[model samples]
Target chain A: MEGIGIWGVPLAIFAGAIRVSTPFIFVSLGESITERSGRINLGLEGTLVFGAMTAYAVAVMSNSPWLGVLAAMATGAVFGLIHGFICKFPKVNDIAIGIAMMQFGLGLAFFLGKPFIQPVAPHLPSIALGGWSSSPQIQSALNINVLFIIGALLAVALWWAFKNTRVGLILRVVGDSSDAARAMGLNPDTVRLLATAVGGSLAAVGGAYLSLFYPGSWNEGISSGQGLMAVALVIFARWNPIGCFLAALLFGGAGALGPALQSVGVTQGYYLFYAAPYVLTLVILVVTSSPTRSLAGAPGALSITK
Target chain B: MTIEANIPTLPPLSAQSGNLRPILEWLARRAEPVAISLGAILTGLALFSIFITVVGKSPIDLFKLMYTGGFGSWFSIQNSLSRAAPLLLTALCVALPARLGLVIIGGEGAVVLGGVAAAAAALPLTGSVSPIIVLVVMAIAGMIMGGIWIGMVGVLRHYRGVNETIASLLMAYIAIALMNHFIEGPLRDPASLNKPSTTPLPAEYMLGSIPGMDVNWGLVIGILACIVSWILIEATSFGFAARIAGGNVRAAQIQGLPVGRLIVGFTALAGSFAGLAGMVEVAAVQGSANASLAAGYGYTGILVAFLARHNPLAIIPVAILLGGIDASGGLIQRRMGLPDATVLVLQGTLFVVILFCETFYGRFKIFNPDLWKRTA
Candidate 1:
């Protein structure tokens, strides 16, 4: 910002967007998969926090970042399993339960996570995406993390499976109409339970990314509703996995705006910048949630849709 | 597809005992919820005890300490009651809109914004206005801001088809951001360098304790608000319209009720109550606005609201019970070397189990008096 002229603003915002979108991509995709199975787990925020704590703790203890990821995944799966079982009961409101589970998860994490706050865990390595650039600034800007690629790949895979696979067909059938699934001699509850577990593990991976890579440590302040935003991202993406990936990147970009500006030497009113991704999400929700056109890929049984 | 081919038709009820419905129906309605609540609490405690044992603690000692620490003595009872004051209003925030079938869980945003608004409004009249007038103005400003915030969510849900749950949450994030901006910049009391809070109201001007009690007047105000809400929901036409809409939205529309207005009105009223909680926190407890204003009360109120089945009158006792648990956290921490979050874990566990137990309400034949004949 000192000598780079007026172009710095947009460039900084673009850079910030990439950095911030990482967690969003992971969590949103996880939510997309769970929601596709007819159960909405609102507690992913807690999962994200707990995942970060587990990853950080494991990394510190074993000196292996990959092991941390695995540990986090296991932790997330257990959380998901609890949610699935509780929701399977008759007349239970999954959304309210999700909120309760979130609080429970956060409490447990805070109770146990107090010990791992100060350690330097093994961090994930990044690739130089901007290697072609000669300038140091450009080279640094191009250093993209590995998790982003993995997130994108997962989204594509989920999209394809959702379209062509029998398992995906069953999930959609269960999500669309449980009575229809019942008629087909399938248990809707079992499918949803498995889906929630899978979704929980994926969301934990997102949490692993937060602690093992970006923001790069476990602490109480690590996540600020990236888990909850994933739910909104699913709606914007119309519950398409691939769309969730792109939407997450967009959210990440919004999240990065303030920090990018701060890094480039414009630190005025940084709090306003922090509100960017949430504001963007609200705007997108209002715009996309119109009564006029049919939401092209919406699941028939979704409660959010009128 | 296979099950569709088979059916066993059953006839409707026409028994002698069913014919004498009024007296039995009244008794069953009163007993079912209490029985379910007790059953759920026992199951929750058993599950939680397992967790405590795994962590190398005795559940019996924990319960004993929690009870004594929270409500064993007169002093502890007052302490628990003090905590219950804010909860009462926050619980109302969720309870009110729930009647209209909208789940508004973003009351923390209203509480924070309302507190900030109250402090900001009072800043100008710091020395000139009478303390009573200033407090009234603070409450009004806080309530108005809160009402408008949630009311907007309700409007968006009705007119634009936006999901109120997400919209309200997003709005809450925005409100917090705004509070941070104002508190850290424009509203920051230069003298409060350590904590970066708004200027504190002088002690003389601050809200004092109620006569014969250590707690402030917030408790009375919150209880009065609950009573008024109960009257509105149970004894008025507006409440009736909201209830009808909650029961069958499409049918309510067919009946020519202004569904949009009721939705927005109920949510707005709910937000106002949450905002009033913030105001009371400002005027009664903190005597100024700070980060403490967003203390997870709003989220906890969601649990309280659901646990009470969104019943306005039922919220009072439930709020106090939860409050006692919260207040006991400090004592348990000191006595058992447990983490402060133990109470939070207990609350969360209880909430999850209770909600899951909603499935059991009419399932058992003995509990359902109409189905009792089948057992005989």
Candidate 2:
């Protein structure tokens, strides 16, 4: 703690936020897409963990981090497909089924992941944003991973496409009112299913980022609740892709608060800091649920609205 | 077959047509849930078997080990019963709330906090108070802690319109952090250095086993609690009001039922049951509060409650059955080269399949007495 200057704290925190926000950005953007299409997949947390395991195993075995990312995307799509198909059934509660799927997904991952915990995996490379800086701390803080840029670009692309494309209108119409889509003879279920698959794939890419990039390893403890937090993050973001990107960064910042403090000679009550993101999530939910004003851009058919 | 032969024949359907038809239909309707639940169980078994086959493992061997490890012998049965004890209370934690249409999954939080509170209470009373009095006080403290925790969720749902499911889950996560804080910081026992735990209760003060059985007294208490819960839900006005409220909020409010009170009361009672589960784990098993208090019982209770169709009496058997499956996990891992999480996979699969089968409740007419042709 002695050699660190006053600026070290803020700089390290910024770097930590970028490193941590990568997963949240992917997951929240994925959720925002799904919610925009009038469906919600609460099982993405499971998908994320499973994706992490799949990516870690693939990267470890084949020494191809890129292949690991693809494998994770495929696995996530399969999970999303199952969630979509089951939710299409009459009388089935999607929320309850989401929880069950989360459990099942986690179980299957742990069962299959038992042997891959110890192995090292191929890591994603980082680009230094502060190559001109003289201090190692400054350079480290500026070193951004590839996923961060990709996530930012994805958010921009999605925000643009959702407003400009024909498919976006169909999705919005379906989400706003299934009856209107039915009147237009469009299959609401099909649109929702496709949206969910795409969302699941993106979330898996986030998981791949966890395993093959930051913290680069295959282990059971790689994820905590980053996947679950994305649900809250999407809500905080008001269902906008760009909003998801910023919200993810904020959540990532909060997530790193504890570790960052520890790094800066504040080690007591580490558990309290570990709880910051959840607390932030809970507060956001409470605020959003208040009756004073409607959530700015809530999908009309979203069941979460009271 | 001999048992059926020895039984007296029931009267023919047509013999008492006018008076008996409604009664028979009523009975048949009452039987609907059990039939559907059984169908779901069968479906789950089929799915599980398919999974085993795909993995190149013999389902029969797995089933054999599950049964043998769960109930074949006296020791195994006792072990299963011990596991079932906390599950009974935890399942009730979910079941009681379902009567009021609340899906409260934060029983894990209540259990963890309850155990911590109970231990915290017991520490000061160890010297001056009689062990029995201290234990009773601890139980009360445990129940109070749990009740307040979940009751808060119910209150939020009633007044603030918070979703109980998510709220309770968030609370559970928070409760775990709180427990970890206490165990690692304030309540750390000096002797137990590596694993943080509260000071252990004296041996005499700890809960004992039931006479003539190796099972602890917690099993009896759990069974009794279920029976009492069954009576409360089935035979009380409060239960009736809660059910009405659960069916339709607008209708209940129109009928002048205090929906808010019912919601809060039911959730509080549910929390107490879960809290008691934590106390039992402490007093009977662990004899102290530790990180193990969050052991997946709270989550398992959700499956048990659903499997029982939220029936308190039915939860007893379902919890016992799940307990048996849980007891066999180690055997599956050792003998079949399966991961420890194999049991979790089975449980998760069963849960999802059963919930899916819930849609089939009234689809079959053969099971409905009203659809039965005249059997002269």
> Model 2: what TM-score?
0.91
TM-score of each: 0.91, 0.91
Model 1, span A1-306: residue lDDT tens: 345566566766666666667778888887887888878899998888888889889999999998998999999999999999988887888889999999888888877887788879999788888888666656666677788778888889999999999999999998888899999999989989988888888888888888898889888879878887777788878899888887787776666676667776765587786777678778878877764543446776655554
lDDT of 1 at A186: 93
Candidate 2 overall lDDT versus native? 0.84
RMSD of each: 4.2, 5.1
TM-score of 1: 0.91
Off by over 4 Å in 1: A1-15, A128-140, A180-185, A263-267, A290-296, B1-25, B374-376
Error of 1 at A281 (Å): 2.6
lDDT of 2 by residue, A1-306 (tens): 335577677777788899999999998888888888888787888889899989889888898888899999999999888888888877776766777777888888888899998788879888988989777888888889988999999999999888999988888888788899999999989988988888888889889999888887766677767886676778778788998998888877766777777777875577676566666666766665653443447787766654
Model 1 chain A, poorest ten-residue lDDT window?
A: A290-299
